[model samples]
Target: MSDIVGELARVAGAFDQPTLTLLYRGHAKVVIAMLRSAFTRDNRTISAARLHAQVDTYLDQLRIDGFTDLPSGSGRDLCLRWMRGQWLVRSVADDGAEVYTLTSHAQDALNLVTNLTRERASLSEHRIATIVNAVRRFNTEVNPDRGARVDILNSEIARLTRERDRLLQGADLTRPSADYMLEGYGELLQLVAALPSDFARVQEAFTALRTQILGSFRAEDRHAGEVIDDYLRRTDSLMTATAEGRAFEGAFTLLRDDELLLQLREDLSALLSHPMAEDILNDVDRRDLRGTVGLIRRGIDAVLAQRNRVTATLREYIQTHNTVRDRELDNTLRQLDAELARWMTSAGPRTTVALPLLPARLDVHHLRERFHNPDDDAGPPPLRDVTTQRPDGLTLADLLAQGGPSLDQLRAAVHEALASDEPLASLGRLFDALDAPLRRPVEIFGLLHLTTNMDDFVRDKEHTEVYRTLRPDGTRRDLAVPVITPGPQSPDSPVTFAEEPRGRAPRLEPA
Candidate 1:
């Protein structure tokens, strides 16, 4: 068994490293000796020719399987083939030729076999002993028939009860509708957003009060009343504000004069005024100091309950969505990673060959024709784009200006470096640091687009005005104002806005 394991290891190693090819070839002689020794107990002499024939037959059989073909000259293959060639009766060579003798190589093989075989047998015995001990202990201690049937029947009954309930509920049961609950959640969110720098401060204070209430049920927590009062006062002040300080009758608004959330509050107020609950709602004052507190508290509780249910539903939805999305993304990423790994392992593309362009040089005006619809319906077939860049005609400065070097170009550079005896590892490291293929900048402006934004200027205190140089000579400057035109529009098109700009100079070009 040890001998077989060693042979399997030697064969597996051959595919892992090219350098180990010749080393395993020398291990054959000992294997053949071990085989001969195993068969030597038979009282018969094995002829060399017959022995060689037997080994050849074994080798033929191995070839039929997936094992690599062994060379006739390889000592290891010779020994293995000879061992398999033997008929039922075993025999040995003496002169290490046909005298049923073992060679020094065969002795070494036997030593390895002895150690491994002993280790394997010891492990097997230990495993069997452990299994037997466990079985005996369990059998002695456990009464398999003791109340098991009752317990099993109870478990089955419970399982069946649950399954029946599930069937009655229907496997495709949907959630309670979002129509009645969304307004409450939205109001809570809006209320949180309307607070000063420490948004949700009142909510946090109330949460602490609730925690304290739970901890000391009977104790007079006077601080809880103070906390709730402070929160109520702040919420009341926010709900009554209006344009030009005119007294308002709503909670809040995101738009002019009337807040959209105030409408939601009114709608909910109406919904809660049903025939069953009208008496409770009617007693509460619409703008009374204490009445607002009760309304806010009730709203907060309703929103909290709705949130808990929605959050659980959202979690289930997200978990199912992510499972499918993650599987697809993982498969795609693996394929991309494999392609990239392969490129790293093998010889990369050569880019020295000059890429000839079409008769007309590509420009922005011709971009649509060159890239999108390059030919008419009956026109000649479009020219296929080539991977190689024109390197010979262009100067180094021009090449550097044209987005540095491509992967193909860099690969060509590596080939050149190799011929000059430069380090390939260092070259590889430089390429590895580069951004991935699609993320790499394909245009000059794309590289520049990443560097600046209006927000950057706004955030910088030093700059009074932000402007862009129109020419390399720096003769002219254009006031940098972001403009978005309504409807489908282009950069060159006139800009328009639904409302007039507030308080700022007309820096943007007029529509």
Candidate 2:
């Protein structure tokens, strides 16, 4: 009982808070009044203009009844509020205006409120057949090894055939009277009422399972493998041992049983068309009778969609848990790839190449256009002068291998410059104090970045040492660069690095 109440509370939190209050007070009639006239009997869609007209009529009637302080009469805002309560769905029309449709949840809620509580139910052939079918389904599905499933099916076929033959022989079989039809519909109505409640219960089960998984995840003592094993165990239990799960399986099987559905459809269609049936069934009862098979199929689809939602959530969590491990695995594979590539390159004539060289440079856009329109540029493209090329054609790896100084060497040289007694030591001063190798733009930028990090050195921004720079096309400019100098270190704090071990991963216990 407590579990059911708890689940109810969870479901209540998911819907509009005002929904239950409004429904309890019969205010659903207000919105439903608009909905009935907003569209035709067969049509589910309502245009904004049509809906406004309905609301206008409703408000005018309210005023005639001497109602006071009513809000502005636009169905648009009212419809939007109902949408928040999951009563309606909206889409944009061709003219960029809104169109509304009644949702399945809203239909179920309205049906439950309007029909199920209106009358008392009693047993009939329909009720008896439903109970027999449900029990048989459970027996075969849950205990298939008991070995009576084939016999049950065979008996059903024989019984149906015997009835057909009796009718063919013109035997005066007792047809259901008016009272019998009403009783049968009462049973059918109860079944349809329970279907939505059944779907809600299944949804609750899925929600509870997700909560359990997430709680286990957030636990400080969680073992990842145990969490996963528990998840699989819960999934199996939900599928095999639960009534809701079995009901879903039954509905799914029914959806694929075209012969059975066709037979049921013909039977119901014939039953509802009887002149006696018309005397008992009102518009509401007729709607229920006409939509019975379709509603069951839709219920089954809802359950399956929930099942898929839970499965997708599990897949997503598994992906999230493995993200770091997958990243590490990728890094290891990339290292292996680099090793293989380097081995291949060293085995050939070129030992200096860092990455594989292309036969020609790639221009992605030009290539795409050329492939699509091969003859568009019939003439050959132009070339540039060879004098534009630089002399330093060696790869960075080749330069490193040939014993040139690295970033650490440059930083150490700058550190020595910062230890001096000058107020501002320019790059020229550093170059004079320590040997600055063939000054390239790369080396200059590297030293400038290194100067930012020295323990007691900072940039003197008010001054700059200008350098004459030459561009690739032979253009020149005077570029201003920062000069570094030693500054007083702060008395209070010093930077320190901490070392901690990566903890052991969680493991699963043996079953």
Candidate 3:
């Protein structure tokens, strides 16, 4: 169970150092936006000069935004800082200009940041229905041997189909409450946020494979040819046989189908235009829903493309090694021929000249027997570390104190009340922190309930909380708190308000 929990944790962990810094470090968002913009449309590689210009333009805008202390060359410095953190990879371009690409780490970091900043979303029956149906379709196409899918389909098909018919007929189609609609929107957005992370995770796997291949080539004890052969074999199995790989490949295949794209676009248009949805769907939500399927498909394509890029690298390595070996074999043969000619000239013709066969390069498919890194605790498609970021702030306490309290008045009251030398403090202290009108019967009860829940509050028979009130005549009267224990087994009756005649205040009693 511990191992399972650790595995799940490892899968979710994708935020790297650059991602963490970008969130809190000033101007980091501008720098990231610049990078994203540079690559967003068509370009994957950005030249130093062009990127610098883009960053400088961004910084200039920052200055116009009234940020005066923005340092000079900070844009370039920021880019380099990302490089140092392994967020960006720099290499010389064909024209000798330095070019940069977002490393898998950088992509993962960006995805992580986006997910982190996303608004809290709720899952709902409608969203769950749509998502589950899509997943079921995927499972049928990708993993047909699974047992429960068909059963689920049989169970939901009639109900869902009838609902769709009613929606199309515009007959008795009622709009869901705002809360329900908002929840559905949030659930959809959460899935959208998660899709990019999945892409980044796959990209990271491709990177890990590339790293392994490079490591194998550089290792002193292993033959490079054998290492590569084994690497290729393992890679194929990883892509085809592993669960993560299968999910990605299934998604890739599904998305790559032109028919599916067309159908998805149509379905989204139809769903959004439906009379039932019209009330709930706003322009932004509609646009997002319309584009979400396409965006997800694009992300999956990018991830698969990363795998192809890594495989291409492996092919290049193999081709280079083969070419080099062929050259060396030719040289060895020519030297042998020279020796044979010399022997013939000195001691007459010999019956035969012996030749040694060159050591063979292993076949690509059968290279599974090569050395794997000893440190790896091999699992499905064996991978290495997930991303981790060094948190900001000077100490653990500082790090923990990351956000503001929910209510300022309540916060101050709780703090000072907790610090008081008195074992028992008046609940009115909290109510006094706010307007008298704000401290209604419900509010006073809420404050009393909060004190009982806090560990700092000492509760005993002697500490039966009492409230003091000063009258217009300057005499004091006491009021008794009905409940003292934390969330009660039987909550008190609801307070009812009654209309009062002319000048008297409204009376309240439990109903």
Candidate 4:
């Protein structure tokens, strides 16, 4: 073999099988080199063949059989597969080789070691803090036995001094010069008394006693603290228990004080499930609270109904009353119209009817003469000098002495007189004073004209004629005047006959 192979084989032979396997598996190259160096020291050179044989034997003994150049299906390959499935220490063989080194089991062991280290560190910190707090608490208390011993020493010293003074006083008179021992004792006593007062020593006694009492109290306080802590612990336990569905102490007390309402509700629910109780509640007529309530409701309804009725009656009465008043007012208005019509007829232009109802408030002679004869050119038809004539001397011829007017002049006069405000009674007298042949006065007092049948006319009254003009074939024609007598006409009495051939005739009695 070559020197390099001899050197590497010798280096690999001295390594442990695990180190050799790790080298072969390509792990911790520096550690593998260091392991190889132990075997490869200058003076310790083993021959390459011997080194290979030893390494091979070690590998077999350790069952580290995978470090080889094996093809598929070789025993070495099988060993490698087994090693791959397990966690075993690994190293190199007698010759250099390469693969990944760590086994699963070795990795797990390292991780476990790391975790244990971390836990040990954490536990160290906790224990250190616990010891610190305990020491701090311990330093604050006095030593009770030491303080009591100091107090007892101080009291014994004071008692011995008093006894010495008393003994010295009693024996001094017997041997004055022989009292040196007493003097010396007194001197020592003085010197000892002169020593600084151990106030701390005295105070230590009270402090110790106080500390004892306080310690007792503190121990009690610890019990109280334990009690409080226990109470808190119990409270937490109760809360946890309740959360986990366990009953806690005093749990029912809460229900009794405040949560009793839940019980009441449950009871009420149970009551509703009972048929008799449910029926009783359902049968209660809440609508009928009291008779007074019903009565008041009924009374209010009645009052409203009465008010509506009264209002309706008042409205009807008012309407009816208004209708009656309106009808009466209408009747009064009709009567007024009729009376007005009568008064107008009496006051308007009058024809020469015989009985004139004059406005008796005026005289006749002072009336204006408005007529003029068109043919004769005479002054207004001569006014009747009847002002001087005796009322008995006026005959028809005397009345006719007044000059008359022509038809046209009379028409003018009638129209003028009608147009004026002259009363109807005056117009009648003026017509009587006229001497026109056709225009003559006729009696008209108490005339009763029948517009219906003659059977309805009243008797024993004078009558007059009324004329009407007509148009026949577009020519002006005079119609026969209607003769109205005051009495009912006999069916055969003077049946007058006049046709259109006779011209319009007056259906009047001869004057």
Task: Per model, state how many residue pairs clash.
Answer: 12, 0, 1, 12
Error (Å) of candidate 4 at residue 322 is 99
Once superposed on the true structure, which residue ranges of model 1 sit more than 4 Å away at CA?
Answer: 1-40, 43-45, 73-100, 118-511
lDDT per residue as tens, model 4, 110-193: 333323432122234334555775664454344357766667567668987987888888855333232332232223223222
| Superposed model 4: Cα runs more than 4 Å off | 1-79, 83-97, 103-105, 110-511
Sorted by TM-score (best first), the order is 3, 2, 1, 4
* Candidate with more favorable, higher TM-score: 1 or 2: 2
Q: Listing every candidate in turn, what is its Cα RMSD in Å to the true structure after a full C-alpha superposition?
A: 41.6, 29.0, 27.0, 69.2
For candidate 3, give the lDDT: 0.61
Model 1 TM-score on a 0 to 1 scale: 0.15
> What is the Cα-based TM-score of model 2?
0.41
Q: Please tell me which predicted candidate would have the highest lDDT against the true structure.
A: 2
Tell me the tens digit of each residue's lDDT in model 1 across 240-337. Answer: 23231122122223223344546656765664553433332233222322233333444344334433433354334333433455568879999998
Candidate 2: residue 347 lDDT (0-100)? 84
Clashing pairs in 2: none
Which candidate, 2 or 4, has the higher lDDT? 2
Scored against the true structure, residue 49 in model 4 reaches a CA lDDT of 44
Q: For residue 82, what is the lDDT in candidate 2? A: 72
Tens-place lDDT per residue, model 3, 84-150, is 8777767676578899777655565565665566554456567677788788678766765556666
Candidate 2: regions farther than 4 A off: 1-109, 116-170, 219-221, 240-243, 253-255, 278-287, 322-511
Against the reference, the lDDT scores of all candidates come to 0.39, 0.62, 0.61, 0.38
Per-model TM against the reference: 0.15, 0.41, 0.47, 0.10
